[model samples]
Target chain A: MDTDSPAGRARGPYAKSAERRRQIVDEAYRMFSTRGYQASSLREIAGAAGISLSNLQHHFASKEELLLAVLERRDETPAAETAAADTAENADENAAVPFDAAMVARAAANERIPGLIALYSVLSAEGVTDGHPGREFFLRRYDSLRAGYTAEFEEVRRQGRLRSGVDPAMAAASVVALWEGIQLQWLYAPDRIHAADALRAYLDLVIVSADDEGADA
Target chain B: MDTDSPAGRARGPYAKSAERRRQIVDEAYRMFSTRGYQASSLREIAGAAGISLSNLQHHFASKEELLLAVLERRDETPAAETAAADTAENADENAAVPFDAAMVARAAANERIPGLIALYSVLSAEGVTDGHPGREFFLRRYDSLRAGYTAEFEEVRRQGRLRSGVDPAMAAASVVALWEGIQLQWLYAPDRIHAADALRAYLDLVIVSADDEGADA
Candidate 1:
């Protein structure tokens, strides 16, 4: 572990390489947000990151891989990281908060980062194409989101928090849809459509307050 | 107006040219749906339509213009045409159906044409970026949709069809968002998420049926 040792000397370039890779992903994320995936060429991203395309490719073999890295980078952010952790913990029934509440918090966090939200809005929709690189990433992301939201809604239903006769699965799908749709609308008119407000509004419609629940259900 | 007359002869080329333009838009629509706006090149689209690049340019002038054409083409379809007509007629209170009900019919129509839905899903989301050609179109579209749905929901409120305490504007926005979100989900998992069913489910939460209205109110 000594800094002067041969292994430590070898670690220098590897560490620098990792840093360089991170820099590339950072540039790609910015470009993907501003210029979009189609317009942001690898050369442009590499140039912006102060590296050559060949060097960038040494880190990410293709644009698709680079796109995934950018997406994963967003996913690795603190809020998203916590959400992932909570998902794993939910199986043990030890999650600190329900999935829908976590999503509301995430949406609030997203408001501070319009660029990332725009990137997600554009890519997730574009990824619906048959051969787009982001296709599988989106498909899996949505599947996971729908399943998580559904489970959370089901839990609320069990507790009699869900409105009478509201289907958890359908509500899950609608919430997922609303988030995606609202964010895109927010991008257009940020002053009007707040993601947190929209989510809360829909949640209120489908969820009963504890006081109201006794009379309703 | 005789077919053999000079003016009539001139009309033939204009008619053919319009048909050729239609051909380009149709081809662009197919490509935009299957390959996406970013991935579908002008050359490839032109090649697919059996026209030269310059010829395509003569018709569309730019990819953005071509994109607008494709989007407008979809908008000019019967369902959209009727919606526009109804919107105009709505001012006189002569509109046969409410906007939300019209949307339900539109969603059902959308199910039959997955390609158009994919095109819309990809473009509307992608259009959120600063300079996307579809940006103006979608912005106008959403603004109009939100206004129309809000008006209809207000009407529902007047009749005691809307759930008590629900905000008409918020519900309008959520429904619009849900449609966009659900369609993308449907693209990924066609069998699992039906557009009409999802819209109806959300509507059921906010809008009471005739028999239930008296009981609820």
Candidate 2:
């Protein structure tokens, strides 16, 4: 009984299971965001998702597992987009790179994904302690992102796009830090600030291109 | 019944009380840093401090109160130092301000403060929801910090020290965010990163001086 079988398509148990998981995750995210992880209860999550406690447990095993799944799903969105951008950027590495303001603008415009951003920030801070599953995940996530940005910086440096004495690894770390930091603040007071504008301003200060000669040295 | 009377001065109740409070905070910090607020218990904290539960409650009214006091005390250290630096820097506002490379270097050299930093990171994330005492504290702290940095940035801008079109408020927010973000990464892998150096590099790129005119525009 494959869920996608043509005969079982209308009465597919797998499809229902998948939909139930999505519904649970969506409810959990809302509850966690509004009530926080400690204060939110599994019963409430189940109630909000319109499922029985047994049904919820059948899908998720435990509250922690459910929370992890929610986080994983949220993280996948940006990871996929960033990966695609990296691949495209890598393909054009040999060519005289045309300034891609549109691509940067698109990433910047993703400021609307505040819930997912907030989820990551909250989970990351919570994950710093030992034995937290997300601890390893966050550590590896940052390492890979830092490595990717550092490699991009090095590539630009090799092409003579960077100024002398500028350390690419350090700069990449700082940029990532700035992005995460602003996201934290934005989570607290979304109405008072624009994370996208803040990020763009930071990028403008650090990243230099052949087209822009007189940027920050 | 003065505890510091000549005979009791050597080991007085008052002195003992003060010592006990310090011991409690130190142990609380350690426990909170490792186990987090929700996971850590008062009995455990008292046990760690080598005190009775009653004595621990005598020092701090409640677990929440103790956590607040511990956090407040921790925040005071950096605020005091920053205030002193602000006063000294403001005194020479007209002069060619010397950058405090040593201060940054000292921060970079020290890796022991990651626990304190991680505690704040975790609490701040949890504080986003309503009813968390730390929510008001962090919100006010950020507001005041942003105001101070904004004023400083405005003064520097008036003196023609920074690039044009840069918003002081946004820049200040970004700076705070970057600082917190770097702290998060450092907490995860203290052995692998120099957060202070990363911060300094980013600051160097963002901040320009009147006397230095090397492609800042």
Candidate 3:
């Protein structure tokens, strides 16, 4: 085999170690998504990854560390996509889509990644309690998300896209709240709840198109 | 003191046992609210209640069973209040308030009981995982809430209270989702997130008054 080939280069200890870590994270993600954080044990994850408990502990000192790794991997996948999209030639054009509309679009996209949704729904809820390893992650996540949303809503309001009587700050909070609530419901009853549809409904109520604004006036 | 006087009679073993059980549940509720379900241990709860581990176990066989008792107590508190109001002389008049509006009122009420909200937010989110002890409770709770909301929305629509272009079923689901989502956010940042305000805003968008409906038509 050619030494330059990806498979031929896998013989090194460093690469093997990295590959093993990736396998552990993948197994943790799967187990966390289905069994949740507290219920899924380190032994089960190590077993699923075809590694011994000692090896897993060497990679991740504790289950909390492994959980953080799994969550980080989940976040990176989307962050990477967004980063790639940001560099695309039509990036500026893509920015024309309003934040609320983009949110609805993302909710639709989330349907295909139910495992991530399951993991998020479980951990974020679990994170609300004191001393949960994921608490700070969620607090920062929610704070940043709400701040980003508030700024976007302000911009939309400035463009006269928001309904005349709507308050941008409240609207921002509502959107975030709506997304979280709808997704939680969706997790409980996926067949019955429509996350994207509910999101779009809410957006339509608060955000008006230029044509609709003209008609309203 | 007379033997038949309220405070004069010596307490029976049954009353003492009931009081002890109540103490355990109360302590469990407090710990569960702040520390969350998974982070809280039976030993700590037992200690907080000033009972030994064996005695605590005698009253409640498992942590899951204790959790159920705590949840049941929480539910009963609200149910008791609502029941009192239901039998009030003006109960018919109170029924005139739309379901969404009542939910906003409840959100405001929930602010005074942040501990319950914390407990609920943690468990409901955690319950999304498979085989969680609270899963059946949350599943039934959400189902009943959604159904109630839908029925109430249907009535409101019949009375011309729901805004035109709003579907009752979606509106019902949205209201429930909004409550859950906003409350979770409130748990994270109590000072910043206005649960009632967000809920009322969403409700106003979906459920308009007679005058607003007339203007729309």
Model 2 chain A scores worst on lDDT over the 10 consecutive residues at A80-89
Docking quality (DockQ) of candidate 2: 0.56
For all candidates, state DockQ relative to the true structure.
0.69, 0.56, 0.59
lDDT of 2 at A199: 65
Candidate 1 lDDT over A117-172, as tens digits, reads 77887788778777789888878887787788788778887777888778888988
Residue B213 error, candidate 2, Å: 2.4
lDDT of 3 by residue, A108-165 (tens): 8777777777788778777876677888877887776776777776777777777767
User: Residue by residue across B143-200, what tens digits does model 2's lDDT show?
Assistant: 7767877776676677776665677788778777777788788887787887677767
Top model by DockQ, which number?
1
TM-score of each: 0.88, 0.78, 0.85
lDDT winner between candidates 1 and 2: 1
Q: Chain A TM-score of each model, in the order shown?
A: 0.85, 0.76, 0.84
Ten-residue region with minimum lDDT total, candidate 1 chain A: A82-91
TM-score-wise, the better of 1 and 3 is: 1
lDDT value, residue A173 of candidate 3: 67
Candidate 1 per-residue lDDT, tens place, B1-217, comes to 5477666675877876888899999899898887678768899989998999999999888999999888777446665433311232243343666656666776777777888888887788778766777889888888887888788788888777888777889988888888888888898888888877888888877888655642234
